[model samples]
Target chain A: SQKIEQNSEALNIQEGKTATLTCNYTNYSPAYLQWYRQDPGRGPVFLLLIRENEKEKRKERLKVTFDTTLKQSLFHITASQPADSATYLCALDVRYGQNFVFGPGTRLSVLP
Target chain B: EAGVTQFPSHSVIEKGQTVTLRCDPISGHDNLYWYRRVMGKEIKFLLHFVKESKQDESGMPNNRFLAERTGGTYSTLKVQPAELEDSGVYFCASSQDTGSTDGYTFGSGTRLTVV
Candidate 1:
């Protein structure tokens, strides 16, 4: 069965440190991947997107890397702060544009 | 420009009752989509609409769920004879182009509870 998995456990990191989250999948080849941030009572907001041909995509303090050979994507938040604490989700563009599959998501908490 | 909007934000209904959820996409976005996440599960796609046309509905669970996009603007999802397992958060998303690259804008979602 095809599956997309992210660390279901909450990740805690010291303030100003780098927080890394991993997303792995099996039995599927996606053209691209996207990362999103979701806060309580709010919808997910798009953060970054990386294509299969791209090794890394970065914006400000956020970075995403996609390794199709490993079927994995890593999301990193640099200089993490309390405001960056939220559930992070990785999604695959299944069937190109028609549908999407999201990972269970990983919760990150930056401690002071 | 406003983002995608959904209403009501939350709904609580008894089993067998019918409920309608609405979604207003960003202006000029011809593509709209519906998705849901049950407890402890990943968000799953329900369907997609392109300017009042059903592009893909392979994710619709059963016949009890009916979705409509009126005048290629706002969309509605109706679940009749709801079941206990229908409890989940329904999300609406829209994009100007196919979501292969730029991500779609998402609504806050309507949390539905069936007792």
Candidate 2:
């Protein structure tokens, strides 16, 4: 079975600063990867997806990078705000999105 | 368009009791998936339903869990004689096709607590 790892420690940063979170996996590489934002008591909402062939993708202030060689992905929230405070999860999809194997998630807090 | 919707936002039941969680996927979606997250743990896949059939149920923990997607419209997950360890948040998600390029849409989830 594949295993996904993320920082368990909560990350605290000042609002307006950039927040970077990492996701790493072991075993075979996935066909694609996705990032999600989960608010307290709510399910994860889709943020972005990057295929193995894609090095980087950006949507507004959100950016995601995929480094298959390192078996890692980085999620960045630029110009972060208090609203960005939530648990961010990275999911690995194999066999053409059968679909997802999610990491434990890293809770980020943007302080005002 | 409405995203996935789960009934009974919260459920509290006693051990040895039964609880049923309902999930209605987005209209026209052919794939539905169920996942659960225990307190302080990672979210784990339970099963996947393609239309009215179970495509993969390898993640279902034990025989105590039953899932159905009759008519391929809505789905139900029943935990029979729920145990204390069954306490967790159940999430339902849906995608239009097998290869979900748009990503899956998840519901708010049903929080289940067994005492």
Candidate 3:
């Protein structure tokens, strides 16, 4: 089975600073990786997706990078705000499977 | 458009009891998925339904868990003789197709507690 792991359980950073989160996987190389933000008492919302061939992708202040060679993906939020504080999850679809596998998620807290 | 919706926002059942969770996907979506996240654990895929057909259910933990998508509109996951380990937040998601670009829209999820 494919397994995914986030860089940390929780991360705390200042509002103006950038927050970086990592997702690592083992066993297979996914064609695309997705990032989602999950707020308390709610489901996750899609943030960004990066393809294996693409080194980086950006949506406003959010950026995601896929490093297949390193078997990892990094998610960054620039000029973070308190609103950005939430649990972020990384997910990948198995090439041979119908469902996606998700990492445990890293809870990020942006201090004001 | 309305997002996916799940029923019984929360459930509490005694061990060995039966519990059923329901989900209604967005209109016209062909792909509906069931996922669960145990306490302190990552969300895990449970099964996938494509227009009333079971595309894949390999993630289903055991025979005690049964899922049905009748009429290709709504889905129900019934767990008979539920165990403590079955307690988790069950989430339903849907998409027009399997394309990663479209992304999947998720429901608020049903939190289940088995004691």
Candidate 4:
């Protein structure tokens, strides 16, 4: 069986600091991984997607890095703000399948 | 463009009652998906709809749940004789079928509370 894991605990950081979150998986090889941001009482919003062959991807202040050998990915948000406080989820695509498996997610709080 | 939209933002039903949740995907998006998150658990995939056809329903919990996408536009998921375990938040997402790189746009979701 395949399993995805996030930090599980909440992370609190000061405003304007960089926040890093991790996602790790085991047993299955995925072609691509994605990150999403979800606020309380709302659905997730897509953030970034990185393929297995890619080492790093960035969009504005958001950055994602994928390491196939370690089966881990790291998501980073620079100069974080209070609005960035939310739960971040990581998802992996099941090979040859249209369904995606997601981790439990890590909650991030940026405080001034 | 408008993002995906779901009806009945919140619902409370008793066991053995039937509830139907609707989702309207973005315009021109050919791929739609259904996912749910139970209390204290990760979000899990329930099914996928490629137009009007069910491409993958491997994650559906049991026969009590049925999802339909008619005319390849809006989708409906019904839970028959809903149980207490069916309480959770259901989300709908859609993406353009321009290969695999495009990410999905998700709806606000419907929260189902079964008592």
Candidate 5:
């Protein structure tokens, strides 16, 4: 069976510190990977996307790295803030213009 | 520009009853999609639509669930004889074209409770 796994179910870190989340998958080769942020009682919002050929992608304080060899992607939030606290999800895009298979997601809490 | 909109923010109905959920994608967005997240599970894709046609619906759980996008405008999902396990959040999203570059905009979603 194909699977996409995040590093942890919940992660807690102090504000201003850097937070790192991991996504791993098995039995599938994805052309691209995307990350999304979902708040409680709301749908997910698109964040960052990285292609297999690209090693890393960055958007302000957020950064993402993809390693197809390992079938893993890492998401980092530098200078994390309390407002960044939410569930982060990683999804695999097998087809460029198609649907995504999302990971279970990791809840991040940036404590003040 | 207005974002994708889903109606009936929440609905609670008994099992075996029928329920219909509607989604209005952003204007000019021709690609519409349906996704769902069940209790304690990751969000899963249900179907995708391009204009008035069903582009892909392989993720649909069963035939009991029907999705239609007539005239390529808004879309609707109807669950006939809803089951207890159908209780979850249904989300609708749309994009101008394909790929992550054109990020998909998702609606707030509708919470369905099958009692």
Candidate 6:
């Protein structure tokens, strides 16, 4: 069976600092990996997606790095703001399947 | 453009009852997906519909759940004789194109509490 894991503990950092989150998976070779931001009482909002062949992807202050060799992906949010506090989720597209498997997600809090 | 929308933002039902959840995907989106997240658990995929056809339903837990996408515009998920473990938040998402790299737009979600 395939499994995805993220930092279970909530990450707290000061505003304007860089926040790094990790996502690791086992027993699956995904075609693409994606990251999403979810706030309390709301659905997840997509952030970035990186293919297995791609090394890194960026959007605004967010950067995502995919290392297929280690079966891990790293998501970074630079100059984090108080408004950036939320749960970050990592999802992977199952090759040839319609469903995407998601990790438990890591909660981030940026204090001003 | 409007994002995906789900009806009855919150629902409370008794065990063994039937509940139906509705999702209206963004207009012109060809791919619609259903996902659920239980308390303290990851969001898990339930099913996918592509233009009124069920592309994949492998994530459906059991025979008590049924999902339909009529005319490929809106979708419905019905759970009959819901169990205690069915309490969770259900989300609906859609993408404009199947092959594009664009991210999906998700609805606010419907929180189902099975008491």
Q: What is the interface RMSD of each candidate, in Å?
A: 1.2, 1.1, 1.8, 2.1, 1.1, 1.8
> What TM-score does prediction 5 earn?
0.98
Q: Write the per-residue lDDT of candidate 6 for residues B1-115, one digit (tens) a residue.
A: 8889999899999999999999999999989999999998889999989989998898899999999998989999999999999999999999877634777788999999999
Give me the runs in candidate 1 sitting further than 4 Å from their true place: none
lDDT of 5 by residue, A1-112 (tens): 9999999999999999999999999998998899999999999999998999999999999999999999999999999999999999998988775788999999999999
Q: List the global CA lDDT of all models.
A: 0.93, 0.93, 0.91, 0.91, 0.94, 0.92
Which of the two, 2 or 5, has more TM-score? 5
| Residue-wise C-alpha lDDT for candidate 2, range A1-112, written one tens digit per residue | 7689986658999999999999999996799999999998789999999999999999999999999999999999999999999999999987575657899889999999
Model 6, TM vs. native:
0.97
lDDT of 4 at B52: 95
Clashing pairs in 2: none
TM-score of chain A of each: 0.97, 0.95, 0.94, 0.95, 0.98, 0.96
- Which ten residues in a row are the worst by lDDT in model 6 chain B? B96-105
Q: What residue pairs are clashing in model 4?
A: none
Top candidate on lDDT is: 5
- Model 5 clashes, total count: 0
State which docking tier applies to candidate 1.
medium
- Backbone clashes in model 6, listed as residue pairs: none
| CAPRI tier for the interface of model 4 | medium
Comparison by lDDT, 1 against 5, better one: 5
Candidate 1 global Cα RMSD: 0.9
Quick one: best DockQ, which candidate?
1
DockQ of each: 0.79, 0.77, 0.65, 0.68, 0.76, 0.70
Question: What is candidate 3's lDDT per residue for A32-106, written digit by digit as tens?
Answer: 888999999999898887878899999999999999999999999999999999999999977422688899999
Give the range where candidate 2 chain A is weakest over 10 consecutive residues by summed lDDT.
A92-101
Candidate 1 local lDDT, B1-115, one digit each (tens):
9999999999999999999999999999999999999998988999999999999999999999999998999999999989999999999999999864668899999999999
> What's model 4's lDDT at B56?
86
